[model samples]
Target: MRKIIVSAAAAALLASGSVAFAAVKHTTGTIKTFDATAMSLVLDDGSSFTLPKTFKDPGLQVGEKVRVSWEMSGKNKVAEAVKIAK
Candidate 1:
């Protein structure tokens, strides 16, 4: 019984941690804003992000549609921005 309880607790902890890691995918949208100081990027969907430390793309300016691969910290998303895929 104690082992079973321990297993359940472990499972719950795992589930909680899993929620922190966001899925990586290609999101294409125009830049709504950019904050160089904060290192944040805002997309046209009204969603925003503090640029992930993993992002490597340059030429990221406002009003450009960029294909980015990002993760989510809850509803907040941060991209490892690839490039402006023209």
Candidate 2:
């Protein structure tokens, strides 16, 4: 009985760890391009994600190298930030 309980507990921990360490949405890259109409960004990592159209005014531009962090919803991802490094 004790062995069975221990195995179940270990399985639960493994399952939770996978979810808790889900892939991070942060990446560092230069803005390859931006289209106001499209509200999309092309990063140097060869990956891209769209910014929330409702976000406050953007203070970034193409060619600026910045760190980006984002959040995911369903199959879509939204840019949570775009910051320049000192």
Model 1, 42: alpha-carbon shift in Å? Answer: 0.7
List where candidate 1 sits over 4 angstroms from the true fold: 1-22, 54-57
TM-score of each: 0.62, 0.65
Candidate 2 lDDT, tens digit per residue, 1-86? 99999999999999999876555578788888866678787887676778787755357778888888886766766788767754
Using alpha carbons, what is the TM-score of model 2? 0.65
Report how far off residue 18 is in candidate 2 (Å).
2.6
Give lDDT tens digits, candidate 1, residues 2-86.
9999999999999988775545767778899977777788889987776776555487788988776777666777666647868
